[model samples]
Target: SQQGEEDPQALSIQEGENATMNCSYKTSINNLQWYRQNSGRGLVHLILIRSNEREKHSGRLRVTLDTSKKSSSLLITASRAADTASYFCATAERSDTGRRALTFGSGTRLQVQP
Candidate 1:
């Protein structure tokens, strides 16, 4: 499988603190995406950075890619209680099926203390 692996299977932080997560994949990829899942909600796309790009940011979220190292990191600044959720890094790769879909990692469950 081309799925990536995320470190820190779980994290707990105060409401106003920051949270960071890391991901590592085994093979070459076309793109990497960050997703957030809250409770029973479906995964929501947070950001997508192509393999050629190194970094991208959105609102309070920051993502960095290291293609050479086959790794990526996501950082959330001044996290809120609402930010409590699971973060997953998915990778898209070329496939013979003519289209590629993201392969999700195990995810990092983040808990924000109120």
Candidate 2:
């Protein structure tokens, strides 16, 4: 599969602590994005970092991309119980169809305990 692979498939952390997830891909990418999904809900966009960027932050999320390593990491700071969800990393690449396609990782399940 062209999709990236996420590390630490499951994580448990106390509320107010930080949670980190990693993803590694095999090909060059235009950009990488992080998303969060709650049970029975649709995915929510978290952050996006372009290949030219080393890091980007939004709210409590900090995303870092390393094109040299074809990898990326997402960090959620001061996590709350409400932050419990499955986080996924998706990479945008130019497909043979000449369109940008997104390949997603399996995802990391984060459980924030109160």
Computed on alpha carbons, the lDDT of every model, listed in order, comes to 0.92, 0.90
Model 1 whole-model lDDT (C-alpha atoms): 0.92
Question: Alpha-carbon error at 79 in model 2, in Å?
Answer: 0.6
Q: What is the lDDT of residue 93 in candidate 1?
A: 80
lDDT string for model 2 (1-114, tens) is: 346889889999999999999999988888888989999899998888988999998999999999998989999999999999999999988456647878899999999999
Instruction: Mark the 10 consecutive residues where model 1 has the least summed lDDT.
Output: 93-102
Residues 4-108, candidate 1: write the lDDT tens digits.
899889999999899999999987888899999998999999999999999999999999999999999999999999999999999998566737877889999
* lDDT score for candidate 2 against the true structure: 0.90
Clash totals for all candidate models:
0, 0
For every candidate in turn, the CA RMSD to the true structure comes to: 1.9, 1.8
Best by lDDT: 1
What lDDT does candidate 2 reach at residue 5? 89
What are the models' TM-scores?
Answer: 0.93, 0.93
